[model samples]
Target: MKKIRFYHTLKAKIVIIIAMVIIFALQLMGANFITQTERQLVNNFQENQKLQMNFLENSFAPFLEMHENPKDTSEDIDPEEEINALISDFSGTGITSLIVVDSSFVVIGNSDTTQQVEVGQLLNDEDVRTTILQGSASSKQIINSQLNARRWRMVEPVYSSEDSQAVIGAIVMESNIESIYEQITDITLIFLRASLIAILLSSILANMVSKAITDPIKEMQTKAKAIAEGDYSGEVTIYGNDEIGLLAQNINELSEEVETGQRRIEAERQRLDSVLSNMSEGVIATNRRGELDVANNMASQMLNLSRDELAGQNILSLLEIEEDYSLRDLVDRKEDITLNIEAEEEDALLRASFSVIQADSGYISGIVCVLRDVTEEEKVEEERKEFVSNVSHELRTPLTSMRSYIEALIDGAWKDPELAPRFLDVAQSETDRMIRMIQDLLHLSRIDAGKSELQKELIDLTALFTQVLTRFDMLLDSEEYRFKNYKIERNIINEAIFVDVDSDKIVQVLDNVMNNAIKYSPEGGKITCTMTLENNQVLITVKDEGIGIPAEDLAHIFDRFYRVDRARSRAMGGTGLGLAISREVIEQHDGEIWAESINRDGTTFYIALPYIPYEEEEWGWD
Candidate 1:
């Protein structure tokens, strides 16, 4: 890995550079200011010294001129005394280093007693002395050996009024310049020190100001780093109403918004998880890359794999499907598709359906594979189809036979009168069989379609049963039939047993069941018809002591043209439509019809009708 560089941040570097520049500028300014201040001090000192020298020269000039007359000088004044008086006068005027030189360029008088100077000896360095001898006023530069410093020397000539241009003694003055330079140095030092202190204080204050600005920025950086790494819990605290504080507040708001967004995303994720976990249909969802993203519990079980084992696996690999069975292709198709995935074992069959999950824009985003165990449902459907085909073939066989036989007799067998009558009877019976089959088909169709309508009315149960029994009275009275075991009971006798029903249909249902009972009964075996009302329903049961239906066939006995004993039923003149049609008519009145039987014990067909019609308001006598 490459090592990261540690570069100074923009704010820090900028602040540091600005402070340095300011300090540099202050130092330069201080240097210039000290130079100007020294110059001013020197100028002021020179001007003050020159003013003192001029005042001394003016004060002595008048006194020296008044005593210059030849006749007046000899009466009262000596030269030495006069010279001393002139030096005293110069000292009294505060002129330091006052000296008097004659016009011959020689020192004439001096203020210091230890140094008595000659009046007229020629001065070797004669710049100032020559100026005074030529009657000119002048200033000179001289070194004071005692103080080891420079001095300003001025010279002036004293002349008589009659000879203004004549040579005369001169006055010279010298003043010290070292004290002025010293004061200038001291003041310059003071200014330099003050400038340095100001620069130092300013640097410290600038650093503090920079820190105040950049510290919050640093905090913001820290918070931003945390957010980038998926931690949204940190906040930037702001302290004042400046730009930095406002920036911190904005950062804080942004963090809150991010946290809220994350929470909402989490909630949505949980909701999706719940939906997937609880879904009944096995859901195996794949991404656009054809990788399995999620698989619900049902999907895991359907694939016979653990949850963890299915995750992140290729969808095709997880399903153990061929490579050509691409989920990506299915999604690209954008239509629902059915795929049958056979089990690994030869005899086992497992089918999986792949559907494309589409977005609102109608693009397929992923694939959802729904798995189901459809073995039983597929088997039942196959059986139902086979049963229907068999029924059709069976019914067609009998109809074809009857039609062929009837046509054969009509074409030729009628030529013989005896054969014709017998053939006609057979044809009639076959026709009746055909009629019964058609009627049974119609009845079953009506019931299945829920279109069977019954003519409902209040019915007296006792009279209906009496009429049914009376219709079979001759069979009951015959000794050969042996009605010894016959019994009829009406438990709701005097109560009228009034029920809302289609009486004619109910009687027909009862008669059909009773006839079946009588036909199936053994000679002298019991035949029972019982009527009772219980729980607001009227129940009629007809039972026979005969060979009963097999347990397995009892459930399907009422199916159209279904016979438990086909040959025996035909021999007994049964069209196999009686029970089916009866069941339809009974059920049309909002009733139930069923049969109970055991092998060789007996068969009982029970019919139950509700006392109140399903449509009570439309029912008569309601």
Candidate 2:
């Protein structure tokens, strides 16, 4: 997928490496061949020069001997002329110059006629003088001054044929040796051309061979790119039964495995999403960097943010715990923490349980926090503690009163007949109050535990309410409550509205409401009982002219032990469980009950019971 330079490619590398090896080999071979050829050429030329010098030495030996001995001759022989004539005869045979010098280093014969003045002069050339004095041969290569060519110069001592050791004269010869070097140069050129041709051919062949190896690899690279792009359907084409082909097969297999793994991962992700979405509690997951990686719907809702908004936010800062705790602190924490989160509508208490996501290598990868809304749970716990304390206070008040009255009777108050009777009566009254409170508590307990069962029967709801009002009317006009005058006004429907209900529980509920009305009503206040049938249900309302409940306490009126005026309700013998019990009974009957009040004006309680229309035949009363 990435762009690669030509020089960095495998094909280019192979070609370059092969080219380098060929060049090195050719250079080494060329150097050795040229060196050996030059050495051979020089040796051959030197040997040929030696033979020429020997011939010249032998020819001049007799002449030199005759001159030295002053021999009686038939004619006067000019040995120098003879030597010159002999040198002139051999001039065109690759020889540059030749000269014969006497034993005292005096030049006798010169091959170049232009320099004939030095024929009898002393040959001051150091090579010639050294050869003549030492009676040895010496040779050196030099460039010819006339022809500007390379040549070998040789000096040999002329020896006597009779006395082989005696030095007679020295012969100097210079021969052109340029043709040998020219031959070597031609060979070197041929070798260079051959090397060039070889390199060109090798490069082409190397490119071809490298292509054979690299083509499949390039295909595999393409396949890898496809895989990276989530295209696992494509497979590499195998070129041969070599390692490349094997790798291609493995790649195909890996593609299949990767596809399968991707599907499984997707399924797991969907499953996780489902679980998180359906959960009642919130869930939050953070990556190793302490950044928000996942936040479920509940989590987002609980945090008053969207999932997208929560993503990539630092966990500590997201939860507003950065100042108090760090990421490492949370990772090492073993206990659940409480977070007071400000939700969309209100503040909520959440219990956050922490867990670490760990790998097999004991590496902590991330952290998971499960958030459960515990607002209601905490409220219930507080209410429970309050309930126990209230129960103790209520029972203790009655018990303390009864104990004091009994102790007074025991402390010789029995001797005072009047005090003893009054004390005993007070003790009995306190005992009765305690018993009533306990009974109310037990009844409420049963209702809360779902152990209370309703005994149902079809009855006249309007007639039942009229009977309850009749009892309150009689109680209000009785001798005991004559001072607190109350009037009952009935607005009953005169028709029987039949409904199914537990008659006894219904009576108990109506009595509690009527008693509270009587206790709170002003003198001669009207307690109006109204019953009507609406929307296939019977609605009964008990309205009284009394000090109404406060607005804030209206919502919690049905909660156990809750009273708008706690002291007033206790003085009126109210157990505070009456309305709570009434609501439970109404709900169990699939009906409804609620209250409406205006401060200092009046209060009204309504009870609606489900109504079923029936003919007399249905109840077999026809």
Candidate 3:
């Protein structure tokens, strides 16, 4: 027995399946052909035997007539001799044996009786005896010991003419059937040989067909193995227009894409490596596994460890912190975390900022560590804070002294009626100055603390602008300030320009802006207030053709207590917090406020307020 390998290749399996199906089909056809041919041969043999039997029955009539008439009595005519002559004639006609049996089942004449036992000694079988007794013909095939062969035997009863009712004897004929079996066996052998040939051809054809299919797959496997070993230069050749050809095309395209992607990735990796090494700040990277996969030169130096020592080590352990503070924790938490890691060999204070590196799917893939030495930055910040505090304190000292002196004069100098009004006016002016300073401080504080709030609601912006312009209506009417150049369009409006806003705060902002415009403008200078709707928000602009703000002062106009000219601002009673407060109010409404100025062209302050109030809850903040 051949040892069958359990692991059959795809080609082998397919070939085996096809061959088995072909062999089975051929076997079925061969069996049907053999069976049909055998049946047909048997039928033909039976038909020939019937014909022979009919001839024998017809010839027996003449012999029976001769026996009845007792012919040739004077010419030495022997009846037994005549019967033997008839048997010999019948034997020449392809019958294997011919015998005449009497009414008592005794054989009288036979062609080959001498070589075997004579008629008197031979026992008559049931078929022959029954035929004579019934006076009818019957046929069967039996094995005869006298001839030592199988033979088809037929027996017919013969009657006498003198007594028609008397049955005389039976004429029996036997034909050998061995030749029919020989012909059938020869046909079967031919079918068996044809079937074997068909099976062999089918097996060879199946092998060829299987090879056609499996060869492409084998080539694909070879290419895939080569790709695994980093050889992306090969191309797959496609054959014929079928699924296999399409698969080959796809494989070729995939190889090209993979090669391109690999090159790009290599370039990116090299660029990142150079950036990390050259950066002044220390950079560290870790994979999702929480191990330090990459560290820059600065990072290695800051940690007082070689790159080899840091690589593949758990970042938390390498840093030697007690708590489980690591890059992994920062990435998993998705929140900014600060860790103070100290160098083992050096006295360096390293502040590390751990940020999550997220993929496009919003999954935290890794963490990026940006380590900076903040020792100098911290010192600078502290010094700036102290300097601001000192400046504020120094400015407050003079204001406080002025307030005290003005109060004393108002209380005592009123007794001198001649000097009372001047003292009272100076006291009020000093008080106003102090009030402006305090208000500026409060506005700055509100912006710094992020506590500014806007109570927004829909209001007729046309009406609001009209009211703002009315406050300066008296100044516009005076000849001391010519208003011909001024263009204040109250009629031109969005019928109901509405904005969600704090009405009181907006009014204060408008008042301060309009007052500054009026005070700075020359007698004939123009002041225009224009309103427009843009991007679902209302843009209200105040334009003034006056001594415009200096370009250098434009950026700092919104700063607390900041002024282009301190003496001029004091003379005009200008509180520098107006624009600062305006900015905060606009921002609270999810809007924006800014100023555009040139040295001499003029200045325009723009305030944009959203039509709808933004809900803070939607921002994912508590």
Candidate 4:
């Protein structure tokens, strides 16, 4: 930063301003005094000239009386010679010249004898003509170029003694007063010299006063700079025990407090940095302007952002909070809020604690948010609920049926051997259903707990499919034939397909798929079975011509206890756990199974398993 110069300082500028104002006032007073004195002197000189013109007017009065009456008493004298005698009589009254004009405006008299012969010339000067008409006096001053002096010309009318309003002629007087103006100019010079001396003295005094005031301030400024550089030892050495010295004392005290506070703040900042960086929960704070000002390391990681990227971002826009709430709303909250947030790559459960950053006076300044990731906790809670519901539902039906059958046996159905045996069989079947459900639940729980493993083997898929289909074909021989008139059409390649998998589990998967197909197929409907080798994998498709599963239910077919037609599944002894277990088995074998269906048509279940390729020599007839 550039240091301010002395001339630019407040004290120096104030001194200059006060000096200029004082000088301007002094100069204005002197100029006005000179101007008024000169004007008064000129006015007195003009008054004196008017008095001299009045004397000339009186001298010419007798001749003017004679011209107005046109009497024979005035004709005895020569007209030219009488005017010459009249003008020459007042030559000593400070009059430069005297001229007389008749009412016809012809000059008739002159104070000089040489101009008397030429006095009959008409005087057409406007001022002389006005004097003749109005019977009054008028004067004008001009600089006489030939004489190089200021002079005044005065014209006075000479009224007739007989008719006072009638003017027969007028007197014109010229006077010189240039010497008075010269005297006033000399007086003005003296005033200007005095004003200049006064201004010089004022300037010196203003500088002394300004320096006395600014010296203390300048010393305090230097001390302040030292304090800014973290040197708080120096104090301002002021001259007197005045306000400036008191101000210097206060500045010294402020410097000490600031140094102490700075050290304390530094230590607190280091501690805060350590705590924020090591904290597990994400912490983000926004300024009152709603832009993010502080975000810890954990916050950056949780938001999938860099520290620089998160800073200065609008908090409301970053979170995309609930439609009804915003960052301001969050700040207004008095309790913590848990919200669901969709992260960049996955969904997350966030428990957010909000606090309004405030001042001691209870003024809200900004907002602070502490966020905790509860994603795994929420997932565990949801899975626990689903597991309990599924397990209870799966066990309830078998328990209810077994209870009904046992009650029937106790209610005298045992008296008839036929009824008794029938009820006993039903009870036995329900017990077997319960056992199978419990076993399946245990296996699924193990798989979910990550404790289950597949028994890997190299199995021939073609022979396996043949054996599974043959068992279904044997099912038609039973009395109540579920596969009656249901033809099993096979589309199998001649080459044998071998896959690496757990043979028993893979067999169970295929058995579930085939059983679903046969169970849902219409009587006399064809069940198509195809096995093809493509891209080093065996694709086995079991398609049935029956009522297909609905579109919405297809995606969730492998979820435990999820049945498309629950009542129908229960009637057909379908546990709804078969497909879920099959999916788990296939995934363990590194294979995939999926089912496709459309409305009112049929469903096709496809299973893909990696196959081992054989050399040409081993196949012999490839």
Q: Mind giving the per-residue lDDT tens digits that candidate 3 earns over 1-106? A: 2344634788788878877887788788878887888778777877887887667656665555555466524356555677777777878766887887767676
lDDT of 1: 0.70
Off by over 4 Å in 3: 1-420, 475-491, 612-622
Clashing pairs for model 2 are 107-119
lDDT of 2 by residue, 82-159 (tens): 878888898988887888788888877887877634766876688877787787788788887767888888888878
Candidates sorted by lDDT, descending order?
2, 4, 3, 1
Local distance difference test, each candidate: 0.70, 0.84, 0.73, 0.81
Can you give the TM-score per candidate against the true fold? 0.38, 0.44, 0.38, 0.46
Total colliding residue pairs, candidate 4 = 0
Which wins on TM-score, candidate 3 or candidate 4? 4
What stretches of model 2 exceed 4 Å from their correct place? 1-282, 285-387, 620-622
Residue 500 of model 3 has an lDDT of 53
Model 1 per-residue lDDT tens digits across residues 1-622: 2332433665556556766787678778867877787678767766776676566555555445533444555556565457667687767543666776555555656776554454444545565656665667777566777768867677666664467676556677666666666777787678778767876776677678777777788789889878777788867989888888999999889988888897896887677778999988788887776778778888776666777988888877666554666665665554444344455642223466677768899887677777766666665676589658745755665567667767878789778878878777776776777677667667666776668777777777778777778777666777856446554433334556667777777777877888888778776676777777778887777787888888889889987567888778876667677887887787677789998986648988888878753454654555
lDDT of 2 at 227: 85
Q: RMSD of candidate 1 to the true fold?
A: 46.9
Using TM-score as the measure, the top candidate is: 4
Better of 2 and 4 by lDDT: 2
The TM-score of predicted model 2 comes to 0.44
Tens digits of lDDT, candidate 4, 16-115 = 8887897788778877887888789889988998787677567667766555456644557555566668677777666667788888887777664554
